[model samples]
Target chain A: MNPSNNNIETQDDIGTTGHEWDGITELNYPCPRWWVWIFLGTIVWAVGYWYIYPAWPVISGDSERGGTKGVMEWTQYKQLEESQSEIFSRRAENLEKLQNTSTKDVMDMPELYEFAVVGGKSAFKENCAQCHGSGGGGAKGYPNLNDDDWLWGGSLKELSKTIKYGIRSDHKNTRNSVMPPLAAVMGKDSVTKVSRYVAGLSKGSSSTAEGAKEYKQMCSACHGVNGEGNRIFGAPKLSDGIWLYGKGDEQQIESQIKSPQHGVMPAWIDRLGEDTIKQLVVYVYSLGGGE
Target chain B: MLEKHKKLEKNSILLLIFIIITISIGGLIEIVPLFRLETTIEPVKGIRPYTPLELAGQDVYIREGCYGCHSQQIRALRDEVERYGHYSLAAESMYDHPFQWGSKRTGPDLARVGGKYSDSWHVQHMINPQEYVPESIMPSYSHMATSKASLDDIGSHLEALRVTGVPYTDSMIENAYTDAMAQANEGEANTKDGLLKRYGKNTIVRDFDGKAGFVSELDAIISYLQVLGTMADLKDYNPDVVE
Candidate 1:
């Protein structure tokens, strides 16, 4: 490849052939030792790999042929499995601990939480990654697992209940909540009025004090007179910044109050298991909202 | 220019064939795997992956294309965390072998549906999905609960999963056998014995047989479901810790 090998000339630059063309010149820069080493290393490795693995062409070769099956017959899937086995073994230990220890204990212990987080990440990736994004970042309707805000409740028992029972799935224990629409009670404009009523609870600047008074009386029964929230009913805390439908768009809130929002989280008790649920709780709890 | 053009054309044709060959090979890899799956390892902590019967039920679920309407993933944002409790973690599905992070949400997400409902409700809902859900658009699976599902291959399914590496243990295997022999009504003892033996004697479950009692397949399904969000109450959930 080197025509210049014959003319071992030196350039002003550290490593190059001082070959000149017209006014411009070709500095025959032999690649760096590291560069050459890497290139040749790759070449040699490729050849070796080609021989050892299924790199050679086969018209209809299965995985064993023309693939990266090394001399040791190693493929990416096998490597992944090996690496995964290590993780699985580690998981076995954690699962063992989960079987013996209580979910509450798993929550309290930092080590268990750490274990829970690692397991949770893999499990989430496998089971919950699609809709939740890679790390439970959430989409339009889905809720995030990382935040402190909870729909059913954030406490261990509450979270467990939510996971086990789910929300509004046909499961017998499922939690059910509905806003019933202020429009149903009154009218759509009244929805805006009621939204203002709900808004008034946060800072007391709602346009309708009478509405707020009504809120303290009617809404307070479930939302708390202060408009905070009632966990039992899954009534979201009105004072909090995390709005499920949207932020405090007075119009939207008004519409929502007029109409209301109903979100559902399916019950899992019929799918996974109690221990798995507890592990999931620990995993979810470790996601940043447990305490 | 003509000679050069011919040479260029020749080279381009060669490149095109090579590219086509490469593309075909890549496509075939995916196609072939769809028919054959590797035996997966069950988590050594004693929880085996879903057995074929249970897996069949799940497949019945997947084929009925339940995922089209329901999503399985949960997010980790504030409201989601608040609503679903904590964000879903990664460890809950370590033994899934082929994890089921579903997409779409015409209905709700089912990442954690274990132990949430009584078995009879599941049966009733399957028979008449809309009876339980007044506004539901889901198809019914009542026949699945009522039919004499082929339980013969369940052992092979477990062994197949065992071949892959899911840890079923002696008792789990035993439970599978004993449960197989019992009348449908008497499956609870077998399920309990199996779970106790496999999970160990100390596992705490106040209502392991809530209402409908335990059927091994149902137990297996519920075991897979009951755990969704109950992991830990996070003091802090920093993503940086993952590396």
Candidate 2:
């Protein structure tokens, strides 16, 4: 066959797409072999995917009817349940042991203690770490778990109770205390004097401070006669330097005395279930502050 | 096949028609299921439409672009379930008009942030997030505290949402402004009783922004935040059994 003839009309000839731009004809070459194979492969894969997974919508009056259940009969919730069950199964033995063991007895079982600590640390990071620091060092108002100071007691049983029924939480059994605004009850001047007296207590000042008289008259009941905190009232130990609102300076003390700000922690029993709370109590105890 | 294709390729309208048909096949498959299927949303109790104040707050949430950083949907994954609590149910946000199931998560999921913190904590966090959370990148919304919530057109908003299938009663629309005010000043003598009567008893009516007189934008937002996932009592829901 002649080259010119083949180019124009012969069966052996390559063809143009019958279009021209600036006197150049477009070639109508087939797609690349790999590209065509991949394109076809994707279509086949998609068909397989649709067959194995939910793909089509079916009309059904029943609210439970989602769609056409593929051969795999898989769902996101089922996948989550399976994955979560795997995790639970892995921890089941330890969790059951911890569940059986009382909060006080958890300390005695070293293996269970280690499990609780690890589990509790993870749970705390997910929940409590946002408010209380990740290291349990505590923010200004948030109580530090690592320190000996606790608004409530620091024993394992106390920690568990506090964690379950939070201080000033909405829980019916939540620990409650109210230091009536001293500035409102007594004069502002008296509040200032009392604040100075309380501030001086942590500094080891002489008991005969300027506001010593006011302290005995107004604040002695809940905050003991010597500024020692009363656990019953969840009051801060005044002898120590730890302050919930701010640094225990005169101004901070004065501000707190004038308008007492009660820190609120959410009750975790409903949120974190009993088993998890048990683990958390142990974890917090291991943080070096358990009494 | 090559010879037959030349006739169709030569015609622009035919090519366009074929393209439309190709695209519609994918679109119909993806979208039709959502409407046709009955179980797209699980049937759970207590999933009600937002109260007027909460609705106003939702508008504020959208206006301020809270969805830019915070996603309301928690995926059904092990970590997400463990962290955010029970994997988010479809029914949890079924009443959401343009659901705030955001794709991006610059901040943590706000799916079950309701009842997680106290009203005061929410107020403080909103005012200055960095003060409480030292490493937070969230900006302060202190301006919302001072800015009064716009309640004048709240009825119209309810009406608009009503047209889009939300079951807003005529009385609810009429009492929209009062209800917004009532929600913010909960404990005052007779204000909240009507609100509680209208919305469910579980509706938490409180001084969300710590200001009682007028409904501030902060109050609206906080009220909205406080009600996020507190609605559906999850104990009644069991995932293992499909209902």
Which portions of model 1 show Cα errors greater than 4 Å? A1-90, A108-110, A129-133, A137-139, A203-210, B1-243
Candidate No. with top TM-score: 2
Best by DockQ: 2
B128-208 per-residue lDDT for model 1 (tens digits): 766445556887664454344456666666666676667766545545544442323345444645544554453323322
Looking at candidate 1 chain A, the ten consecutive residues that score lowest on lDDT are A58-67
Relative to the true structure, candidate 1 reaches a TM of: 0.40
Tell me the whole-model lDDT of each prediction, alpha carbons only: 0.57, 0.84
Q: Over the stretch A1-291, how does candidate 2's per-residue lDDT look in tens digits?
A: 666653442453668877755666665778999999999999999999889998767776564456777999998888988999999999999888887888788899899999999989999987887778789988767888898887889998888888898878778989888888878788988988888888889888786478989988998888888888889898788877787777899898888877787778888899899999988998998999889
Please give, for residues A126-197, the per-residue lDDT of candidate 1 as tens digits: 445443456665543456768977767777788788878877665678899776766666655555666777
What DockQ do you compute for every candidate structure? Answer: 0.02, 0.58
Q: Candidate 2: which docking quality band?
A: medium
The positional error of residue A37 in candidate 1, measured at the CA in angstroms, is 41
